[model samples]
Target: MVISSQKENDVLIKPDKVIKYKNSNIILNISNLSIGYDKKVIAENISFNLKKGELVAIVGVNGIGKSTLLRTIGGFQTKISGSIQIEGKELTTIDTLDLATKVSVVLTEPIASKNMSVKELLALGRQPYTNWLGKLSDEDIAFITKSVSLLELTPFLDKKCYELSDGQLQRVMIARALVQDTSIILLDEPTTHLDLYHKVQILKLLKSIAHKTEKTILFTSHEIELAIQLCDKMLILDGRTNPFEEPCKLIEHKNFETLFPADMISFDANSGSFKIKK
Candidate 1:
C-alpha cells in the first residue's frame, strides 16, 4: 500500500527553512555539491544547511551515492564541483589538522588496531589536543571520562577492544569521536553489524548528542524507518541528486517507495512503516 495523508494539500513546495536552537550554530553547509571518485560523479546537486542540534540521516538504497556524499563532505573524497562550508568557512581552505579538529568521523569499518585497549583506542581521539610525543593532561582525562560515561563505556576501559561485543565496540568507536570534540560528526552505515536493540541505542545516543551538545550531525544509515522516526531531517537521493527533506513531507509526497525495492514493497502511512505486499 502506498502511504499518504487524507489532506489534499499539495505535497511539494520550497522546503522549510532550517530551525535553530538558542546559541547553536550551522556547522555544515553544502551547495550544488557533486562528489566523485577518480573523476566519476557519484553524487551531485546536494545543497543543505545542517543546524546544530539536528540529527540528519542520509537515506538511499545501496550504491545510490550515500557513502560518496558523506566522503565528499567529510573531505575523504574531493568534490568535483560545489562548495562545502564547515563552521561558515570554506572546507578546502582549512588545513588537514584544522579540518580534523572541526569534523570527527565514526565509520562502520572494523577497528584496525588489534593491540589497543578501549582506553588506548579512545586516547587516539586526543591526538589533536596532545603535544608532540602524545601526552594526556588532566583536561584530556576529563574529556575522555565524559565520553566514556556518555557511551556508558566506563566499566570497559581496561578491556581489549577486540573482546567487546559488536554493539559495545560500536559504542566505543562513538566515544572516540566524542572525545575528538569536533563541531561536526559524520558516520557511514553506523548500524551495520548491529542487532535491533543496539541499532536503536546507537541512534538514540547520536540524537542525544546532537540535542544536548548542540553539535551538527550527518550520518548515513540503511534503516529507513528508524531514520524517519528519529532524525530531524533526511536526505533522500534520486540518481545522484539528494533532496534534503523532513520525513513527514516525504510521506505526504508519496515518495517513500521510490527509495527502495520498487514494486514488491510499499509504504504504510497509517502505521508509518514500509511493508511488503502479500
Candidate 2:
C-alpha cells in the first residue's frame, strides 16, 4: 500500500557514465481516455504520457479497469471517449500491420502453439515484415538474433515452448515482443502466474529492457511494491482519482495510503510497505 521510489543499481547492461538521458519524444499519449464496453464506461478522464526508456505500471484493485485501459491502448478494444496516440500518430488511424510495427502487446493468455520451438515462436514476431511466403529476410534474422541475445535465449532456441519454465517462457514472450521492433510495448498482468522470485526477475528484466533499449514499456500489475521499486513512473487507477506520477511523488501525495480500505491495513510510508492492523 505504500509506494516509494527505490533505485535499482544492479541492472544488467549499464551504459557508460550512467547519464540520465532526457527523452523528449512521447511514445504513448492517452488524453482524457474513458475505456469500457458498449456504452458503459468503467473509468473516465484518465490521462497519461509515456516516453522512451520509461517503464510504467498501471495498478488498482480488482475490477478497476486496469486491463480495460491497457486493452484500449493496445487497440484491442474501442475507447468509450478521448484519444490515444503513439509517436504523434492517432492509434485508431494506424493500419493493423502498421500498428503491429509501432506497438506490441503481451497478454496473460498461454501460448496456443505450445509445440512451436522457441526460435519459431520468436520468429513469429516478424510476421508484420515478412512477405506472403513468410520467409525471413536477413534483417529479420538479425532482429530475432538480437532479441534472443538480449533475453539470453540462445541456449533454448531449439527447445519447444511447452518445455520451458514459466519464467523462461515469459522471457521468451518478451523477446518475441522485442523482435517486433516496436517503440511501445504493452503487457497485461505479465506476472500473473509467477512466483515471488520470478515476478521480481521478470520486472527487473523489463526495467532493464526499457532503460537499455529506450523502449516504452507499460504493464498492469498487482505487484505494486515491486512496480514502485522498479518502474520509472506509475499510473494508479483508483476509480475515484486516477493519478499518474513518479512513485515518490505519489507517495508524497499520500496516494497509496488511500488505495484500499484503512480498517484492515495500514501503510508505512517510511519503509514503503503495508501491514495488517489489529
Candidate 3:
C-alpha cells in the first residue's frame, strides 16, 4: 500500500493537491464523503487526508456520525456520495481480498465467544493471508510472534479473553489489528470502558504504534481532551463544518469551543481541555 507518487486524478478535491506530512506519503484520502442509510445523510461534505505514520482521532458529539463515518470508510457501510480512496485508488473499486490487505477495522462490538484464548484471537487477524484450510504458515507465525512481542501479549497468550480486564482486552484487540499489518487501521472507541489513566495509556500506545510502524491509524473516540494531547491530528464531526486539522491548529482556530453546548461546558484553549462553566 505504499504510494510513492499520486496520479493526476488522485489530487484531493479540497486541497487539489497531494498532502505530505513529515515527508510521509498520504495513505488514506476522503473527499466530500457523505455517510448515511436509506437516503438519509447523517454526515456530509467530510474531507480529510491521512498520511502514513499518523495517529488521527475522530471526535464529535453523540449522533454526529462518528461511527457511521468510520464504518463507511472501512467499507462496511454504503456512502451516499463522495469518494474514499486508498493509495490513490477509489475504495469501491478495490476487491474485497485486496482491500483486506489495505485496511484493518476494529469495532467495539464484542467478540462472538470470549472463551477463545488470546492466541486464538490474534491468529484470526492473519486470515487474509491464510490458506483455504486456515493453516498458519511459518511467515504468518513469525508475524504474529513479532506483533505479540511488540504489544507485550506473551503473558496473556494462553488466557481466555473473558479472563482479561477491559483494558487488557482492548490491548488484545489492538494487537490483533497489528497482526493484520494493514496500511490503515480503523477502530471505534478504542479506549471505551477504561479509566482516565488507562485511556491515556491506550491512546499513547496507539500514538507510539503509528509512529514506530508508520501505519495510518484512525479511530472514533469521545476522549477529545486526551486526543488533543496525544493524537497527531483530529477530525471533529461538528455536523456543519466537520473540521480536520492538527490539535494545535484546531485549538488556535477555536474549533473545539463549540463542539458542545456553550452554557454547560466550554473549551479552554489554554489548557487544551474542556471545562464546566459552573
Q: Which candidate is the best by TM-score?
A: 3
* Model 2 Cα lDDT, one tens digit per residue, 92-169: 788999999999989888988799999899989999999998899999999999989888999999999989998899
List the pairs of residues colliding in candidate 1: none
Worst 10 residues of 3 by lDDT: 6-15
Pull out the clashing pairs in model 3.
none
What lDDT does the true structure give each of the candidates? 0.82, 0.87, 0.90
Model 1 ranges with Cα > 4 A deviation: 1-24
| Candidate 1 per-residue lDDT over residues 242-269, each given as its tens digit | 6788888878877776766767888887
What is the model-wide C-alpha lDDT for candidate 3?
Answer: 0.90
Candidate 1, residue 239: how far the Cα is off, in Å? 1.7
Q: In model 2, state the lDDT of residue 7.
A: 41
Kindly list the per-residue Cα lDDT of model 3 for residues 32-61, writing each as its tens digit.
899999699999989999998899999999
Per-candidate RMSD, Å: 8.0, 9.0, 3.4
